[model samples]
Target: MGTADAFHSSRTHHAAQGAAISELVDRKFAGRTFGGSIRRRLQVRSHDGPSTDAGRKARQAILLVPEHEGEASSIMCGWLDASRRVAELRPFSSVRTSHKTRFGSEIDLPEAEYEAATEALRVYLSLQAFEITFEVPVEPSGRLPRPRRLSSAAEVPASAPEARASESWGLIVLAALVGFSVCYLLVLLGVIG
Candidate 1:
């Protein structure tokens, strides 16, 4: 393959590997005394304004923890420690932490710094027996929203009694059909003739 093709292929491979590792970590530590695994992708943009191409970077990381091991406050503290370590390693970026009652806590850092911190966090978690993995993006500024519980389609609103009634009717129809089929079969076999 050509150089460009090879590069693209390698990038795709790397991304796939990262996703697979994330899935494995999630499966291995999702339950059983382990809090779920979290996969995060963050964007680092120029703090100056919205439409500025001055400096931007992107980073991604995954972390796993025991279920309820650390509450919000403790997680924030750990994030602060991780950010500080990242800053120590790479002094090129500024890192800030914010805590809001509604939004929880967040650590905003430069892309490079974020990547470094994520690596540091991964290592630290490993030592602490928590599984984690991370990857740095070639192009910066790609943000992924934190996962949250979403209402399933199966969920019905309290006001949607009509829909519920329809579902019940369908179930009744299904039961009637099954009953009819069983009776017909019995008659055909001379068992209930």
Candidate 2:
């Protein structure tokens, strides 16, 4: 290979231990760089919540890239309805992924969507470049939160259960918003007690 070309080389290394990883990328990529391989995986999923979760017509393809070596990244999907409006995704690091199916507007993965997903993966796998931050505060129950600036995910040392409790604040806030919306609707209809 004199000139640059995609997929310069590929190799898989199996450890002597148990099955920890399925595949590893160790070769010249896009023919532009050599060495410093990034761990990656391609996954297809029907629904995120559970087996009972709907959207049978929906399907998601996730390209998992460890932001940091050996660290797991979150899965995300962008679903487009008949109106061309993409379903809102949260805690989604990349807006490139999506859900597609025959019933929806998109029958299969489109060129642009694939390109976006690859681009996002490229950035995350980049040996160098880019930064993002988001932070939120925790308040005691039955008390209003104080104003504060937020930053991206950070390394917080907490117990296992506490860590989960903290990460779940997003759901708590969402539920509160839903409750307020319902209450407002009831008030507008003069159905409030």
Candidate 3:
């Protein structure tokens, strides 16, 4: 085979092996993938846009742009092709093309995988937060608390009956036992403690 053919063959092999971050593209997968179909991420995302003048105002985080300028078109095609191949191999799902994108790429899966992907994404995003804290806002909005008068027991209708305070009798009994124990201990000390 010619050198170009050999290169393409090697790229194909690499794409198959590397899977989600398909080696053919030489661009890191920008995530939000993995309903087991990886094609949809080949986006010129909002970040990758200066697709218009206003987009240029924002400093964007560009990811998944291929390594070399000359190979951009081929790499994009190869990346997409590889994604479709990977999508076809998904055990529990198949590629669904119904949902479209301006980027002209979509790799959806069966409904089952689509459901599971939400949880997978949740876990994925959760782990992405290395540090978490309830820090205050940089500039606090000084706002008054809105007073909401809670509904009285008398106002509750027969439908969806309000929970009776008497339902906590077991807890009250437990508290009484604890209180009795404390009283008994104090009395035993002979100081009416």
Every model: Cα RMSD to truth: 21.0, 21.4, 20.7
The per-model lDDT (C-alpha) reads 0.36, 0.33, 0.33
**Candidate 2 lDDT tens digits, 69-153:** 5543433432211111112222222322222222333323334444444454344323322122221222324244465542222
Q: How many residue pairs clash in each candidate?
A: 6, 5, 0
lDDT of 3: 0.33
State every prediction's TM-score relative to the real structure.
0.22, 0.19, 0.20
The ten-residue window of minimal lDDT in model 3 covers: 74-83
Tens digits of per-residue lDDT, candidate 1, 68-90, equal 43442222212111211121122
Sliding window of 10 residues with minimal summed lDDT for model 1: 79-88
> Distance (Å) between predicted and true CA of 137, model 2?
27
Cα deviation of 126, candidate 3, in Å: 1.4
Task: Give the higher-TM-score candidate: 2 or 3.
Answer: 3
Error of 1 at 49 (Å): 28
Candidate ranking (TM-score, best to worst):
1, 3, 2
Best by TM-score: 1
Give model 1's clash tally. Answer: 6
Distance (Å) between predicted and true CA of 162, model 1? 64
Best by lDDT: 1
